[model samples]
Target: MASVKSKAGANNESSPYRESARAGAGSPSLVAGAASLSLNSSRAYALEDFDTIATVGTGTFGRVFLVRDKKSRGFFALKAMKIPDVIRLKQEQHVHNEKEVLTEVNHPFLIKLFWTHHDERFLYMLMDYVPGGELFSYLRSRGRFSNGTGLFYTSEIVCAIEYLHARNIVYRDLKPENILLDHDGHIRLTDFGFAKKLSDRTWTLCGTPEYLAPEVIQSKGHGRAVDWWALGVLIFEMLAGYPPFFDDNPFGIYQKILAGKLEFPRHLDFYVKDLIKKFLVIDRARRLGNMKNGADDVKRHRWFKTVDWDAVPMRRLKPPIVPKVSHEGDTSNFDVYPEDEWKKEPPVPPKDLEIFKNF
Candidate 1:
């Protein structure tokens, strides 16, 4: 396997996915030194036109940079992945799966994939930049959210998962990191790397251990219902600031998760508690948001009575907390890391690898 390096410098290659931009025609040219950036034929503008002001976060696959569009003067999170490294790690199939799922999904609650393109070495994904950062970090900073705040966030996530399930796609990964905040502070589900289209059922041991459902850990023929189970865990974390089934040892947590045991805080609201119980049910057939109840059961929960279903996406409701960054290009408060440290040539994969073919 080849080691991966950050693609944080300019490169020459025409993007295979370039197309006209949906935002409009006459988008500005991408800026120089914008790090492996390229224009997709399907997109009206090149990704490099935007100035990358700061690094929001990083993961094993790639680093997400906070960039501003020179044309729209808008903010966006650019997720850059090394194609050669992905194929070398044998994750090309996973990448393909994510792209397929992303292409088919279009919903308010889900993270928007504006466009995707690839060059000789890297894959670039231009995505909706949610400024508020990870929902997990927000929760950690605040310790725990109020009942109202928790319900509001939970409701949005439930809708996103419901929509994916309806499309026959199962979001195997559901954690705070995967959940991002839109400009209005609403939850947008991101990172479809672990997602899979379930024609019937699948048994893959994937996803974070804490958020994994019992059926997933058991490697049973799990379906879309696993998302519902994770929703329960998500709600628990939101309300109590931690998952109901957690331990220092992952094995212990898995055992508790399999047992379907839960310990709610005394201060949790009755409705919230009840909803968690229904979602965390051991029997997938009996879980909430199943074919019977669908997403309406979650929307109709007593805790969500004040929620305006139509207005949630519009962000008409007051956000629990607004982020410090007020504008798209505002990086005044953030101390951006030096680009040189992250700029290095990625390793090339062997010719035998099929994953590097399309990328």
Candidate 2:
């Protein structure tokens, strides 16, 4: 999850999932705002409260650990980010946005942040431990999903996306890597580095190249419309086994996206194609979710006609891929990494202390 900062059109390989092309110059008000947000639960936590179990995920600024709470013996995903790396990478605002948004929203399909704590060297976010690993791993294992399976998963994501938009938050990062399967196999959206609340539009160049919208690539001020565009890319990847636009590099991928050429596999039906097309439209205003009806327009599309809206959020719908977890701390669903890297603490500079004062 290391962030790669490069000029536009450069090939960024740091993340096989989402990559941050440009980092914000840091936001003081935003950081202060995030610091003031109250914890979701009454229980306050710190690094010593949990015993580290395994390394479930890693990124540019930090790594996610599967940790067990000492008091309750409960399992949780602990996201530990190095404060110096956060400042050096210019991801302070994003780190704050993630905390603020997670602190504010509660959705069945979205990952939950229990509490946040910061010591001199690192920022820690305690969240629910999703035993099921990234949806990307499963998709690769299966090659691709059947129409029924794809529809079921996409429907759940639709519910999650709708929930965020209703609260005026745009989930700018939407990809298979960010989607995690719960023990029951339902989707739990993760990673809020690119998510932000928008009254109008934001002109930050972020997100994965394959899923980036044309508006985002052009640096046009974008709002929630970008989420719909990524949804289209997500649907395409789910159904076709790959994104519609592809190239060896990010620039080429952007070209294909701007060209707006979509070639579906012979297996995709007309209804599914129509749904993706509407979501992938180059014009933001004419896009399905950006239309007058908003997310209802997406929910009402013909491709999702079979979905039970009420059941989707209630988690009544069975997930297609139930991860084989042995116990509460079972991490068989996630990939293993060298544990030593997490032990080597990075040096923290004193100059950056005020930036994370609230943390």
| Candidate achieving the largest lDDT | 2
What lDDT would each prediction earn against the true structure?
A: 0.64, 0.75
TM-score of each: 0.81, 0.90
Residues 293-319 of candidate 2: C-alpha lDDT, one tens digit per residue: 998888898888888888999999878
Q: What is the lDDT of residue 300 in candidate 1?
A: 80
User: Alpha-carbon error at 286 in model 2, in Å?
Assistant: 0.6
TM-score of 1: 0.81
Which sections of candidate 1 miss by over 4 Å?
Answer: 1-48, 331-338, 346-359
Q: Give the lowest summed-lDDT range of ten residues in model 2.
A: 24-33
State model 2's lDDT. 0.75
